[model samples]
Target: MIGGGAAAGTIVASADPSLPDRSAAELLVDLQNAKVDGLSGTIVQSADLGLPKIAGLTADSGGADLVNLVAGSNTARVWYAGEDKARLALMGTLGETDVIRNGDDVWFWQSKAKTATHLTLPADAEGKKPAALPTGVPSTPQDAAEQALDAIDPTTEVSTTGAAKVAGRDAYELVLSPRASESLIGQVRLAIDAEKKIPLRVDVYGKNAVNPAIRVAFQQISFDTPDAQQFTFNPPPGTKVNESTAGKLEAELDKEHKAAESSKPAPAGAEQPTVIGEGWASVVTAKLPKASGDEAKQLDGVIDMLPKVSGSWGSGHLFSGSLFSVLVTDDGRVFAGAVAPETLYKAAAK
Candidate 1:
C-alpha cells in the first residue's frame, strides 16, 4: 500500500488512448545516465524489522573494476573488461565464479566444479533485465502504471498529499488509504522526484502501532555509460561451482533458510527478537555476537558508514545518531547492548 505523488516537474504526461512506448534505446540511455564513471561510497541501510544492517565501503572503477565490495566479515573482488567478462569470489557466501557475458550468452563458471552454466531470464520480461539497478529509476510509462496498480489496494485509492523537498530534490507527496477498514499498511506516503522520476522518501504510519519509515537520497549520478565489465565475475582455482537453472536452486535455498531460522534457539541469555515501529513497542532482550578479524573489520567499515545510529548516547552526543543497527546472524538473529559494539568485538574476537 505504498502510495506516491509526482511534483510539478518535467514529467511527460499522455492522455491519448495510444500511450507511448519505451524503446530499448531510451532504457539503455537511462541506464547510462544513471551510471557514474567511478564511485567509492558507503551505503547504510536498515528496516524497522531489525535485520542486520549493511555498513561498508565499496570502490568501483566505473564499470571496469569492481575493485572491491566489503560487507561485514565478507568481501568480494570483481574485475572485468568490455561487457564484463571476468571473475568474482564471495569468500564467505557463494565462493567464487568465472562469469562471461558475451552478446550471445551469459554464463557463470563454478569454481567448485569447474564448469559454466548459462542463464536465462524469466518468461515475463522484455529484454535481459537491464544491466543496471532498477531502484529509483522508473520503468516505461506502462511500468509506472503497473507500479501504481500494485501500490493501490483493491479497497484503496491514492490521494495526492502535497509537495516537499527530498534529498534537495523536489518531489510530490501522496497518501495511501484503504477504502475498507481491513488493510495492513494503514497509511503510507511517499515522495517521488518529478524530474528524475525517482523515489526520494517513504514513510509508513499507523494509529494502532509504531510506524516504519525509510528515506533515501541520491548523489553523484551520471548519464555516462559504464564499461560493460561491471556485470562480470570470475572464480579463482580450487573453488567449487553449483549450477542453478530455472530458479530451482534459489527456491530450495529459500526454504532451507526458513527451516534453519525456525530451528535456531535464543542465545545463552537472550529472548526472541522483536519487530518494532509498525507493530510492537518494546522488544525482547537483544543478543550480541562474537566479533573477529573479518567480522570486526566489516563492523568497523559499516559503523563508519552509519547515516544515523540510534539506541546509543555517547557523552550526551551521538555521531551514528540517525541510523539504528543490531547485529544478526544469517538466520535473522539479533543482538544489541549499551556497550554493544564493544561487546560484539570481544565476542567475535579470536
Candidate 2:
C-alpha cells in the first residue's frame, strides 16, 4: 500500500491530549473507512505561497479570485447530511456566496451579484457530486486531506507524529513527505479527529520552511444533524436565475470530446502537453494559448513583470514560489510543477 516514501522530520506536539497511539497504516485505514451522517461547521482556509504581490490581489478582492485563494485567509460555513445533501456558504466583506445541494437539485447563489444557477442531476448518475465551493478553494479539511492522501505511494514516508487537539476534540497527526529531492514540497500533515476518524485539519509546508504554505482547518464544528432548511434556497426578488440539466452538460461534454478526436492533429510539440518525470518531480510542458489584440497585450504585460532568465533551455520568464515553479519560454511554451526551478529547466530542455 505504500506508494511513495520520504525522509521523516522532527515531530512536535501541538497539545497534550491523552489518546491511544495509532500507526500510520492504521490511521490511513481509519480515514478511509470514516463516515459521518450529518454535520455543520465553520471552515477556515489560508495560504501564504510566497507569491509576488500584485495590486487588488488581497483577500478583500472577491472571495472567488485566484489570487485571493492562494495568498490570504477565507472562511466558509459548511453543512453536510450525506453525500447528496450539503450546503456551503462562503462569507466575504460585501456578501456571501452559497452552494446548496439537495438530492438531485443543486443551486449556486451569489448574493453580491444577485444571481443564481440551478442544475438538475440525471436520475441514473448515482454517485455524481457537485463542488462545494469554487475551483481553487477546498471547502473542508476532508477535501484537502483527500487530495494529499491520493499522493501517497511507495515514494512517500507516512507516519504518526503524536496526539493533538483540534476544534475542541482529540486528534492524531499524520505526516506525509516526498522522497524525491526535486520536489519543492517538504511535507503534508493531516489532523484526524480521534473519535470520528475524519480529518479536521490539513497543513502543507514547503521544503525546509518553518510555517505552512497552505492550511485548511475547522474553527468550529458540530457532528449533530443540521436543520433541513439550511439546504433550501429561495432566490431574492429580481435575482437572475439560470437553469441547466445534467443531460445537457453530458451531451455538451461528449460533443466536445468527439470534436477534439476528429480534428486534425497538430505537428509534434505544437499545442499538446508533455509530461516529464513522474510523481512529485513531474513537470508538465505545453504551448501557451494563442492570444491577440487586447488579450495579447495583457499577457505580454504580465509576462514582463516576471523575472527573465536564459540558458540552453532558451529565454523566458520564471515564476517561483515556496511550493511550485513555473517557466514560460520565449518559444511559446510553458512548464510548471510542484518542483524546484532546476526541475522545470530540465523539462524545458527536453
Candidate 3:
C-alpha cells in the first residue's frame, strides 16, 4: 500500500455527475488534434518506486533521475511557446536549476553550482533534418501524449473511464492497459483537458499496487502566452560557462550505445538493454562491466548499501521503485523492468 503522505499528492478525482458524457472516439480525435499556442504551469512529480532507504544514497545519485521518479516529490515551473521555445525551472531545497530553449540555442543553468551550460542545435542540411529538435528537457504532457497515442497496438487495450478534474480543469480519463498477463504494468491513466484536448495529468500503476507508482501533473496552469523574456537567460558574472553543440553530443551517445551492445567489455556508460519477453512483464537485460577481484569487492561495497535480496536465481542487489525494478547480479549482469521481481528472476535464470 502507498503511504498516506504520497497518496495526498494524487489528484483527488471525482465524477462529474452533471457533465454530459463523451465517447472514446471523440476524445481520441481531440487528443490527436490538440495544440496550444503557449502555456505555463507548476508541475508536481511524485513517485514511490519501492526502494529501500540507504544512507548517502539519494535521488540525486548515479540514478538520480530514475530514483526521483519513485522516492520523492519535485516541483517545477514549466513554460512552453510552440515547439521551438520552452523553459523548466526545477525548484529544490538547494536552489533552482533552469533549462531554456529558444530556436537553435539551449541553456542549462545550475544555481547552486553557479554554472551554465550552453548548447547550439545543428542546422539541417539542404535536404535533411533531425527527426525532432533538441529541447534538452522532458517534453510537456501534450507533446508526450502524441507519442503515446501513436504507440497503440495489439499489445495494448485502450478505453475511457469517465471524467476527472485536474489542476482545476475538467478532464476525460483515458486508460491504456497491456493485454498480456506477463506484463508488470496494470494500467496507464491520462487525464485529458476537456477543452484544451491536452493531457493534464498522467498516472502509472503497477500490477501489485492499488495506487499509482508514478504521477506527473500540473498543480496550476495558464493558457495565456508567457512573456518572450522567459525563454532568454544570461549567466551571472562569476558563473562557470561551458559550451557544446548538439551534433557532437548525439554522436557521443550513439558511440556509447554501440559500445554497450558489444559483448566485449565496455567503459563506464549506460548499458544497452536486451528484451527477454513481450508486453508488460518483459525483462530487460543489460551487460555489466567486467570486474577483477579488487574491482568486484569495491562494486560489492557499493551494492551492499542498497537493499539486498537472494533467491533461486542467485544473489544480487535489487533497486526498485513503484513503476520499475532493477536487479544487479553477482556475475556481472543487470536485469530490470516495470514488472515484479519474480519476472526478473526468470530472465536471470535464463
Top candidate (TM-score): 2
Candidate 3 colliding pairs:
47-70, 49-70, 49-321, 49-322, 50-321, 182-281, 183-280, 183-281
By lDDT, the candidates rank as 2, 3, 1
lDDT of each: 0.37, 0.82, 0.72
Off by over 4 Å in 3: 1-20, 56-67, 122-139, 143-151, 248-273, 293-295, 305-317
Candidate no. 3 TM-score = 0.77
Number of clashes in model 2? Answer: 13
Worst 10 residues of 3 by lDDT: 1-10
- How far out, in Å, is residue 226 in model 2? 0.6
Q: Write the per-residue lDDT of candidate 3 for residues 1-350, one digit (tens) a residue.
A: 11121111122223487665665556666776788998999988787766777644643555454456457676778888876778888776667778788878888788888998787876652222223322222345655566556545557767778788899998988776777676667877889997888899888788756988777788999999999999888888899998877777668789998986774565567477789876566788987766667877777777877667888889888887666788998777899886777888888988
Angstrom error at residue 5, model 1: 18
- Per-residue lDDT for 160 in model 2? 71
- Candidate 2 lDDT at 147 equals 91
| Candidate 1 worst ten-residue window by lDDT | 314-323
| Per-residue error (Å), model 2, residue 61 | 6.4
| Candidate 2 residue runs with Cα over 4 Å from true position | 1-17, 55-65, 125-127, 249-269
Q: Model 1 — TM-score against the truth?
A: 0.36
Candidate number with the higher lDDT (1 or 2): 2
Best by lDDT: 2
**Candidate 1 structure quality by residue, lDDT tens digits, 264-349:** 65345555454332111112224444356786678655554544322332211112111222343332244333222333223222
When summed lDDT is taken over every stretch of 10 residues in candidate 2, the lowest stretch is: 6-15
